[model samples]
Target: MRTFEVPTRDQVSPEAQAIFDNLKKQVGMVPNLYATIGQSANALSSFLAFQGAQAKGTFNAKEREAVYLAVSQINGCDYCQAAHTALGKMNGFTEEETISLRKGESDNARLDAIVKLAQDITENRGRASEETVEAFFAQGFDNAALIDLIALVADKTLANYVHNLTQIAIDFPVAQPIEEPALV
Candidate 1:
């Protein structure tokens, strides 16, 4: 089997090295997945810029984290699941709440709508169920919010696909595996 090693500051391009320095300064450590992305000449910088722009969209930090959790879970991206689980907690979700979001459910009605919509979008490949879309709007999300949510899905999916393809080591606390139901 092939192995993907996380690139170090010294091994990456100067632009990526500079980004690594900034990430180390800002996030304390450059995550393995992000460092892996740094192996590419432009992906690290482009991803950061995309993420930064998405951060300014309609969803708040917590809401965005919820979307990430749901999308990551649906996509079965363990790296993203672990990373977003930690990020969800940082944005104020309790451990249980994060797990629930990963399962595509939430106690809060509005949040439930958001998480469900994220999961639906991911599972259906952009063709979210009309019912889920209706519920999202019923929770007071406008068209702008819908557009932002789609963008968030796209953003998270990019990272998820990268981690899925590379199988990099996770730098965050590992997320617990969700159990599957036994056959009847």
Candidate 2:
């Protein structure tokens, strides 16, 4: 099995080093997963641009975090699960709510619809069921919101796949695993 190391500011290209400095300034510390991405000459910056562009979308911070949590959970990316759990809390989701979102359910009906659709889209490889799509629309999401949601899923999935492949150390508090309900 191959092992991947998280690159330091000194170990990466000048562009990635600048990104590391900016991330450190903004986030306090460079996350291990971001550091790993920094190993590439431009991946860190490209990812930052892609991630930053989400703010222009219809989903607010909380909704975006919800999608991220659900998608990360579905993708089994421990790193993103931890990261987004913290981010979700910052975006006003209680810890329990974050857990629920990760489980592809939520106490908020609209948020539940969002997570369910996100999970379905991820698990079904972008082919969400008509029922799920209707439920999402029923929750007041328009076609633009749907497009934004899909973009959010794709963005989150990129980090998920990177962390899954690299198995980097998580920088945030580790998220508790969701227990599966027993079969009746």
Candidate 3:
């Protein structure tokens, strides 16, 4: 269970309420994870803002799911892994692909690099090594994508932290859970 009550739209600050309203319009409902974060308007708004900023990454939808799947798995955020697993499917990731990502493997070479980069960020706490970043670009990403990786990492870190703190219920179904942890 969550450590404290998750405020509804009316309970949060006006900014968070507006964000929540927009979220509902876009996604049909504000996710419970978002609801919990809404306890802090800054956090909820920051999460939403980072998501929009990260959309420019070199990682495509499939690639984003790959990175999210890998990082969520490593962070032991079952809720996030589950949510992303479902999204991965919606974004065209196969069951085997999702499995490979959680294992830190990737058939799509470009995404392999992104997944690895996300893992490195998770491990290094934004101080990723030069070699790791070099490998990411060498694999085909550009500087802009590299910059977006920070946003992706920030978004995932936020979600994973929420999951770790509260085993948030998934708003969607997911593939089989990744039992092996790949470290946040």
Compared with the true structure, the alpha-carbon lDDT of candidate 3 equals 0.79
Of candidate 2, the 10-residue stretch with the lowest lDDT total is: 175-184
Candidate 3 TM-score over all chains jointly: 0.86
Would you list the clashing residue pairs of candidate 2? none
lDDT by residue for model 3 over 123-178, one digit each (tens)? Answer: 87778778778888998778888877777777887899986887656666755865
Candidate 3 stretches with Cα past 4 Å from truth are 127-131
Better of 1 and 3 by lDDT: 1
Please provide, for model 1 over 69-124, each residue's C-alpha lDDT reduced to its tens digit, 9 standing for 90 to 100: 88988888999989999998898988889888888888999999998988888888
Please report the candidate that would top lDDT against the real structure: 1
Q: What clash count goes with each model?
A: 0, 0, 0
Ranking by lDDT: 1, 2, 3
Ranking by TM-score: 2, 1, 3
Q: How many backbone clashes does candidate 1 have?
A: 0
Q: How far does residue 141 in candidate 1 sit from its true spot (Å)?
A: 1.1
